[model samples]
Target: MSNVLPRAAALAAAALLATTGALVGATQSSALPMAPTCRVADLELAVGGPQRAGGAIDYPILFTNTTGHNCALRGYPGVSVTDARHRQIGTSAIRTGEPISTVLVAPDETVTAVMRTNSRSVAPNCRPKSTYVKVYPPNSGVAEEISYALRVCGMFEISPVEAAD
Candidate 1:
């Protein structure tokens, strides 16, 4: 009987320690901070310029977070060149370059994605003319329009979004 009591007490103590450790881990995990994702409504979008890069015309698309909170962005922004009547002038921008990881943008911070077009070199099959570029931020439905003199082939190549500064 004496031996049974000692063994049972040891088992109870071990179980208690295990339960305590699990609780501590759960508490720590729950305390970790999390930021919200950036939305189209919380951002201001602009096109920098039609800079010439080698054989392609590179347009630096800038996104500025206007909200006061930090937000996260990942992947590519949807881009399409549009005519004066808002008609799509070409195929939407396709993702290019290496895969990008999630980027956090603090309040008033900016991020950029380069849109490269070989409109001047594309075959005549690609009818390329546009008065504006419509941009959709990652994971957003609301699009922002940027007016710029852009000529693109029926296809667009877009680099992944990266930190501007």
Candidate 2:
């Protein structure tokens, strides 16, 4: 009985150690991998608007490529809007696949992404939402890139529905 007890304890300890090792190995292997050699630098966001009916909100995002190696920005950079209470109210998927839309920024050049929101409605929720833009490396999901806020506000001002006739 005494020998059996020692053997059982040893087996349990070995099982525990093996389990722990597996867990650690899994965690280390499944980490959110580091970004590719490319990165976003000098990211800036500016919002302009409050124009009349059918006008547009000009949300120009500017950023520089500080890295020595050239990098390409693909598609329209993702833009997200947050309200006064810091709640994300809306998202603008404004990347049009226009020619020259996504291009490589050389070592020190600047890249600009212009996003336009059509002011076709004046719904309160869509009325001048305080917003910011975050740029991610091309094809990198929204989760990967750090966000940078715009200095200005986005006012999607449209005449009331009745006025649109």
Candidate 3:
């Protein structure tokens, strides 16, 4: 009976230590630094219905540049679509206007840019897939953007979804 008490106490202590260690690991993994604010502005992406390959779909990108200083509308950040295996199957780029002009969104200005997806190039089947949208400096990686990065990060369906549906 005397020996049993010491053994049970040691087991309890070990169990407590294991629990604490797991909690610490979880906290550390969840700590991601927040994105820095380049200006007081908000930007969003809206995708219309999906069209088949070699077809066209209207995509509207909306942004409100609210800072007093004018900001340059460089280019598309980075757009990608991944398959079930998490492999990147499609990469998208921003197609600017004919003259490829730079947008200078003045303070408190709201802007909307409309672009058509080159379905043949970006999406073939136009099926539902995971899409990521990012906004960064022109000719820069999404991760390299010091200011902010916008990522959709999940299921995004191209217009029509399917011809049957």
Candidate 4:
């Protein structure tokens, strides 16, 4: 009976130490600062070229971080073709790429993604040119408007943001 009591006491002490260690670990992790997400106000977007290939026209969507601190971008930017009045003219861009991986942008750094639009042959009804391309950075509610000449039949796709090299 004496030996049994000591063994049980030891087991109880071990469990208490494990619980305390787990709590300390959780606390440390929670206290670490999380990276900030990129916002439209912190970015300057540029749309490059009509690199035509096959039945599609591709453009490089470049995002520059103009903020003073580092920020992260993940997934795809919300893209839409907008008319002069800023109303959506066609379907928003659908994401295309491998699973989302976070891309960190330092001050004055740039990141890029591809924006693809189908040719008129594929989307014959894609008439009524768009006057602006509205872009929303990933994980941000704010949007930036960029003036561009994009004709759409409601078909648009955007690849996930990645490090620009």
Top candidate on lDDT is: 4
Per-residue alpha-carbon lDDT of candidate 1 for residues 56-130, written as tens digits (9 for 90 to 100): 678899989999898878878999888889988757888886688677788999999899877456534555567
Q: lDDT of all predictions, in order shown?
A: 0.80, 0.45, 0.41, 0.83
For model 4, the superposed segments whose C-alpha errors exceed 4 Å read 1-34
Against the correct fold, how does model 1 do in TM-score?
Answer: 0.73
lDDT of 4 by residue, 40-142 (tens): 8889998987788788888888999999998889898889888999999857888876577788888999998888888988778775888998888888888
Clashing pairs in 3: 49-159, 50-158, 50-159, 50-160
Model 3, residue 96: distance off in Å is 6.1
- Which 10 residues in a row give candidate 1 its minimum summed lDDT? 23-32
For TM-score, candidate 2 versus 4, the one ahead is 4
Cα lDDT tens digits for candidate 3, 1-165: 999999998887778778754332346434333333333133323333333434444454445555555555544434444444544544554344333334555556555444345443454544343433333333344322112122222223221111111
Clashing pairs in 4: 126-153
Query: Candidate 4, TM-score vs. the true structure?
Result: 0.74
Q: What is the lDDT of candidate 4?
A: 0.83
Which residue pairs show backbone clashes in model 1? none
Instruction: Indicate the TM-score of model 2.
Output: 0.46
Cα lDDT for residue 127, candidate 2: 36
Query: Against the true structure, what is each candidate's TM-score?
Result: 0.73, 0.46, 0.39, 0.74
lDDT value, candidate 3, whole model: 0.41
